[model samples]
Target chain A: MGRLTLPDADVIPFGSPGDPDRPGRGLGPSKAARLVGNTGPQPTSPPAAAAPTSRSATDADRPEHSTSHDVITDAEIPFDGESWLEFARRRLMGDYSVDDFGFDPELTDRVLLTLVRPLYRSWFRVETTGLENVPADSGALVVANHSGVIAMDSVMAQVALHDEHPAHRHLRMLGANLVFQTPFMGEVARKAGHTLACHPDAERLLAAGEIVGVWPEGFKGVGKPFGQRYKLQRFGRGGFVSAALRTGAPIIPTAIVGAEEIYPMIGNAKTVARILGLPYFPITPTFPWFGPLGMIPLPSKWLIHFGEPIRTDHFPEGAADDPMVVFNLTDQVREQIQQSLYRLLVKRPSAFG
Target chain B: MGRTVLVTGVSRYLGGRMAALLAADPQISTVIGVDVVAPDSPIAGTDFVRADIRNPVIAKVMGEASVDTVVHMGVIATPKQAGGRSTMKEINVIGTMQLLAACQRTPSVRSLVVKSTAAVYGSGPKDPAKFTEDMEPRHSPSSGWPKDSVEVETYVRGFARRRPDVSVTTLRFANFIGPRVETALTAYFSLPIVPTVLGFDPRLQFIHEDDGLEAIRTAVLSPRQGTFNVAGDGVLLLSQAIRRARRQTIAIPSLIFGTVGRTLSPTGLADFSSEAVRYLTYGRALDTRAMHRTLGFDPMWSTDEAFMSFVRRDSADGEVDVA
Candidate 1:
């Protein structure tokens, strides 16, 4: 080997200074050999070591490649796709776990419970009753009245379960598509362990022995006029009952009061809403025309009451499919929840009562 | 024969109540409540018309109703919602122009009572003496653009000048409080905790909502002309007002407090964006002698009385922890 002497600062190690013809050095021998042919005795120079004080003139001139900056190596691939348990453990210092659907365990519950606590406190003030009726361990399907144009009541219900319940069981919510469409909101929903309330999602969560919540009234229920605040909207085809029957989960009818007063929909801007591609522009004391600043809900006191769970264990497997059975079951649940809310309202003196 | 009066912005907190009060009076035969959003139900015997007063269509409607007086209260009261002086000019200035034009075309229209604000003063001197109707608006060119109050006042004055026969009375109202209040300042001061200065006291003034309604009623019934300062007895310091709020006081530097408040509160900073900040910081004791003398009106509640009433009502309702 010939001695290649250079200045102290200019010294380069062999195979370090990439050959003009060969760019990817030390990536692997095969990649290096492919770049620079193995046929000749290429002069072995010291690695291209630049002085610490010197700026590399060619730093900005690097060639562009097809691969992304965040590409993972083949070795990084786990046996069965990335497990949320492992990812959360490594990323979140094992402080988090994965829910049934691979959501951040600790964060999912934390966000859900935190959002629900204030709502639960508010709910207690308005119409809360039958806290003792909630079973300690069994999976239950909580069907509640939904009102408040934005479905803020659903969030209130989820919060009620997490904060008021002794066991602190995480209630998986079925959110609407509009919620997921809003920016910064969609990610929060998913991480908080809410999924679409479609049959598959309901079945999956219920089958895993997890408490599932469904608002049968959906948009129609929550978006009712201020005049019809406490009135429950029409429940759609008994899909909740079918989900309960399929998973053998008990149906727990729930009612929420005071969510209606938060943002009273005094009027609607139908023309503006249609033009802007929105459901309906609510002319509350604040909203859309007022911007996001308007969305700050009035701190109205709330009340939530959970009724005794109707056991479906004794019913036949396909009992939900029977029209008469579904209709009767749905009516019974709705009437019970409605009556409880009215009684609670009567007992309470005012709107914030 | 009973007279017909047209009131716009009747759906607003102040305007709506004013309409209700006017409609209840037996002297007013027909009260036409005009607004973009009509009330769910008509105000007793009053006729309700869901029409944007800014629109030309209002002239046809008002003419048909045989409106003898036009009480122009349909204004974007909040500076935050008004956008800029141009916006204020558009709705307050031009809206008045259109309504005035409608009134002129309607032969029965003889009077115009405008609900202007003491804001026209734009942070006047804190002297105990009251301002007269002839007193030149204390607004300065250096104080930035005119707010809705000033613009609306100027527009009404110009309209009065052109149409001499049409008796125009501009009521420069001070801070008024009563039931169904929606002002940011009122809500802020009524909160469980009010952010205020320990030593510095800015003068505060208010008229009861009933008093304000009474003033409007007086303006409508009487043959009064020109401008009048519709205010209570005197001014109360910011400290006194905050204390009256009954909420715990968080003493913070005005500048720092305002910065944090503007960030956290929706109405806080945005409300002050207009020259209204000048009035908020500096003391302005408005003179209400003209309102009392001209309209033969006396406010039932003073600043202290109004504040205590608000605190009592709010506390009793448990809407807020006044203590």
Candidate 2:
């Protein structure tokens, strides 16, 4: 090593240009070859040879073996695995802030969404419709029906928007307070671009030209019994409508089918939910019987249909403050999504088809 | 252009340095540096007065000097530094009470600048993302530097009410980190294996040492009348700060960390106080609108840059460079 000592060498191994945290594997041969070209005995390589000798001459007065080897190498040593190093690098270099809401895109892309993408693609076999309804590049609220014992439906919708849509827009999802209060889940949710389902967070995201997704029905939609599958619940107190009105974001009412069948909730374990400090402990058919294995969602064919955008810009100022306008808009959005669910159900042959 | 200024706590680095800066100004005729003990390094062009602020005789210093301005920079940061917990309280709380009392008595002292910390806004889960100067803390701090700061501010408020003519400026600063400032935060970051509260990556804001001194200088020169939240803009998460320092972090369960940290603090392994633990768990950020809009002063460094400056000077590789 002519000039490239431990202090001068950057410990963060350049993996890929756009995303350094994205692992670049099987590069030992090429990197070793480059090292040979730089430090080899052959002095004929003009460009590489000239670069080091000139710098080493400038460093001539500097003592040999001055750079602390044992101490420097110990701190600079990358861990064994690629992913751990990526995680450590992200954690160490302050590469965690992707959004003001503490969403780390690298973490979401490489870790969280990486785990969800397979489930959305192969396991659920989700086929999205009316992707054109999603605004190609601007801010729009995607209001979808929520279900499944877990919020796999919402996770899949996020994957759908990111992977399939023409613009590949990232959904700044509005999650429940429960999702943000729970220990590990809270961090994962925030890193995956999910903030509290509050108006301020929603309005800010929309104002910044972000696609925000909200399940207005909330736990009522997710924790509903199997008998009420495909039946829509109360669309909240119209908070999402108020947020859209405040920001003038067009509301794209989305309908997601087959999430209702993923883990069909047959009973409610209210006592257990209370003890565990959860909103609701859903008891499904295979849940109590098969244990952790039953938590695995069925390979239900998912149909996500995006309806036409409902314009809120035409409304005058203070429309968000007006309860009647907000109520009507909420009802209109709820009606559109309900109708889309009915139309999509007619086309589907079976839940698993 | 001739003005007499009294700078308190000249024994400390910030206080001693600020007094020297004040003295160097041609407009200022006199700079009197007051402290309990003589400063280790001399403050040029300033008369050093060895007198504790806790004593009643400090009132005589203000009265005799005919001081027009008072810069109170005598706040104790840690109990360990002040000899013990009770002594820390006496110096921080009683010292402020006496100083404010002396200012109240002296009619000529029209300008008062107090060095305060952002710990007045206690860290808790219910706290707002950014705390404005006027907003009350969600949970009022019960102990340590936070509680003392709150008590000091209360006394200052009382003083303001009594002497409405006086221009009172309180600079509630974020954690100070720079090339030379060895604050509690710096000490924590300097640890080989930094212990972090599990599942909480709290956001932290820092002001550079130069920025902090500049803020104090600005307060002295301009004589603003308001309690301002002075901090560098933007924020760095606790984990990110540790990472930037190139220090290894061990995620410790909060309960276990609490016991171990408390045990180790006395041994001088760490400067972990209950207030510090709360801060590490739920970090605080200040809304610097008052600093920018009202005070009309801009910090030289942002939050990230201030933290990086400290890291550049303190990291393992930089150790040799520092020497």
Candidate 3:
């Protein structure tokens, strides 16, 4: 039999705050309830009484949906379970949509991204800068150096763009054929919005106005020994360059530091890898000798820095067909990424700092 | 101009339906339905002719009737439907060759329409997201009806080049799903416990039976030269389709994935061969912009809508709704 009251912290974090200039418009049961005494559950509450003041304000006609939503947010602790149950029910009833590339946005955002967020945030403690270089909308190809033998670097960058960027753009990655050949990894990668590293797939994603990511270094960059770490590998015949040229999408050269220390490959068992039909059997300091537990990535300090976009629109038509232009562009992107990687290395205090 | 049209494979559902449809058209003076066996049910408008297209006798039928428009819809999809794999290949490859040879000889034929399956663009992991009409399959179909289709299209092209007067329209239709129609996919979905490849949810595209027939009708009415990919707009994920069907799914390991349809589903109907397994592993999509701009055919149902329509008829409750 008392007025509804809540602390500001109880408000939902999802919605932005309403106008402070508009009095009594915040759906504030907090300040008003304390002042109005225990004359409980009255139809004429303080907010209703002060409605006239709000009515005279600039946004009087605007609804207090945000205020109500904010209050509803975090109001009930068990709502997440209910909402998740609802999501499951919807999924069961086939009420979701997916892109032609088999990208399930709902599942990716709610499940896949949520699973990796902890690793990106606390475990790796990834620091990302220069994300503003990525366009808010429109197609842009992100060319990053591949590292972290397990491909954690790409996923970490994906998480960074989704969580940190202003646009929250989904980076549709161009993965190696090997990724799609594997069972669970292939399925998860597609759901996370990745396709084959072929030119057609890359061009198609770009044409659809999506931010596409490609690691040109591929296996060589990831499988190199710890001693050879941070040395740029051959950027795959400039296929990514031609794709950018054809789509007229800007190529963003990205540099990722700290991934090299994750596994620290000391040697490679070539024959065993070939027998197992794998690219290379990596022999990291703790791997194979320490068993599955060694699979755990070291908590290396991570820094993902996105550099300025290399414009492809300025080039004349048929530049993609010209090997000279493509090779130069590929080299330019490589140098930019390598330089930034060194810069980030100097900026960081230590490996696990 | 009431010109006579000859339709092949009239015993099959789609082929029979196509014949009846063409027969009903006032523009066509006569619709002759040719096949190896008698139609199961009586066709209303079409004049059934029990003649095998693989034989030179088909040329006689075309010549006597003075068939001007040839609608070849006889390419059987499943081995069971054709009795065996060899027979399916014989009918698809050899029958197509003979049919094209017959078409080339018949001077009256002016418009030739072939119903091709999108499976010709073989599915593989290293495939593009969407394949255009000109793009070749990354992994050429090693076996089954997909390879047969490749051969069929080739012969059709050869016939096209030999006779430039005829307007050759090849409509590459995606998997068909509807209440009345029966296909390998429908048979697979009808299994008691739907089995899927573990760790893979392939992208699926479907065309409603009505939309498919309408596409054929569109091409027949307004003949176009180049091949066009025909399917309802949008795509449905295999997992989404399973959920929509309200079926329990068992994920089989990829190692044992090849024989899933053969072992689980009824003995013969479902054709989950190597090419099909590859499709279930990594799905294929078609670029259908040309279907709209060049072919001038707009499907009434989107991909998911076509799938949901099938699901609606599949279950007794018929209560399919978005959550």
Candidate 4:
């Protein structure tokens, strides 16, 4: 299925790739122009030529290079002189601070996010909508439909919020136990500000005024057959709803489309899954047949839409404990995400386009 | 009208310093230091009583001294220090049982402060970011100091219930790190090249030696009822701490980290049990809000400040900062 219809602002704000600094500026052309003039080349790095010594060569060249770029960088790069060296020194000296969640703001903001930018921008071509629904400040639980065998959709959504939004807030993701059980990836996940998808961690992060993201669909949505692509799997016991209700954080149902096309899970090897202690052993179109090359997700055009927030604060004190209230809210969030998915699917031209 | 105090495990670092500090305090009338062996260095202004807490004689010591405050700091962290795992268990579990029994009998002992560990929370992938006072381990620990701490807490709770009038303060402290105290954590950091579990950067919290002692002193002077998590203001990622200490790390696999740590650091300064290995992988943090509010005790140094002080001073020399 494909669309020949013209792009609309109601579906998505703007073409994210067009604006380098501010990704989504379809709100207004005049406002975008005013912002570009005010912000300048600070948050993101300028073109290679504008700053001659933009790339760091070695520890020896750092001292001279740092002084030259001190004015341009001190605000964002944040160290007084020789930012790379100073950052390294500060890191080595253990001068840096991490939150109780082991979230390294410096590492996540500069390094981890930078690593994911290319995937979010060039590869996925992720375009987001209804960012205004996400509170600029304060806590909000982002309930999103999980898909894409590899789960690149979650990362893209995180990047979309951080890059596209006016406030540029980070989404503290609640991840599965597998993400944390695996080697190397676990540490990266924590440093990137992710924790185990547990009740306590979710409530704690929310109470601390963090934008918490949870994919209740989990592995069921991720490793499902390609035929059942857009169809949402069972949301986990509605734990996300309880966490939101407890913290009184409004639930923002986020819909991420085009991720299901990536990897295209044709079948699942149940025996292999059982042996390996994984949720499912995904047999994608390119995977196993193409070997390691198959791991590269299909360049599917991504569309993320944030729905209107469902207020949990209005509910009664013992609402979190009430199965009826939780079930109702969970269904509401699921329906909203499903509705947005259909809307986004209609707007996008094609999977690759 | 100063309170008479009885301190256990005065032979070790934390207990000896605690006894010395309690003896110096104007609020304490007499410091009766009880230990199986003599302290490594004599604790001034303390009446040293050669008493094994495992024996029933501790009750006699408590009765004779007319001790108003009982501070149990003898819970050993590492098995190597206590000769074996069984001995460590006996000292930690049975020793606490005997000590509590003695306190229960000695009517004069109105206040009890048991120094517990956050290890009772038990580190795992399933653990919460910060453990509150009431939270239990995700997996009930079956072995090591974590298990011992859990058992010790259970008995302390039982003691509180039995003796309704006695004000029992359970301070669940995070990892101890400072210039003077020599713990498994301190020894692990002091290594020429520390070995860490690969692919895991655990979140660790620390309470400086001075702050820990001060908290104990406060408990002794003005007793508080109920449990409290005693940690400094913040937490530290293990990797950052290693780097800050300027120690090279050889990361071993999670499975074999215990083995590598044992073989590499033959000095037995650090524990390499399954519980400790899990801790190395997923470190634990405590909610010390109750310590600040209920106990009215404020730590002078934060976790970061406390760790940095230890790294700065300890790495300079293997010797203790305080004489």
For this target, which candidate reaches the highest DockQ against the unseen true structure?
3
Top candidate (lDDT)? 3
List where candidate 3 sits over 4 angstroms from the true fold.
A1-82, B317-323
Considering lDDT, where higher is better, how would the candidates rank from best to worst?
Answer: 3, 4, 2, 1
Error of 4 at A326 (Å): 1.2
Query: How many Å off is the CA of A131 in candidate 2?
Result: 4.3
Model 2 chain B: worst 10 consecutive residues (lDDT sum) = B314-323
lDDT of 3 at B44: 74
For DockQ, candidate 2 versus 3, the one ahead is 3
For A1-353, candidate 3 gives per-residue lDDT tens digits of 23223232121211233233543211322232222221212232222322111112222222321211111111133333557779778878888898888888777777787788778777888877665566655778999988878899999999877655534568899998888888889889998999999888899899887889999989988887776667777888999999999998888889888788899898899999999898889998899888999899999988887776788887999999999999999989988887777666666667777
Q: What is the interface RMSD of candidate 2, in Å?
A: 2.8
Ranking by DockQ: 3, 4, 2, 1
Best by TM-score: 4
lDDT of 1 by residue, A1-353 (tens): 23323232131221232233533212222322222221111123211321111222332122211111132221233423545567444443222233323244455443345445544454433333443344445567888888777777877666555433433446677766565444346435655666656666677677766678888888777666776677776788888888888777778788777778888898878898789777776888787658888987876766676766677766886887888888888988888778766654544445554
lDDT of 3 by residue, B101-122 (tens): 8999999999999999899999
Q: Write the per-residue lDDT of candidate 1 for residues B1-323, one digit (tens) a residue.
A: 88899998887777877888888888888888887776755576667888866779889998788889889887775555456656655777677778877877888888999887776666532221234556554444123233656767777888788778889998887776765566656666655556553333345677777888898889998859988888767555565465555556666554565565565455442344435454554445566667777778899987667766766777778765632
Q: What is the lDDT of residue A295 in candidate 2?
A: 90
Candidate 2 chain A, poorest ten consecutive residues by summed lDDT: A65-74
DockQ of each: 0.01, 0.20, 0.72, 0.66
TM-score of chain B of each: 0.88, 0.96, 0.96, 0.95
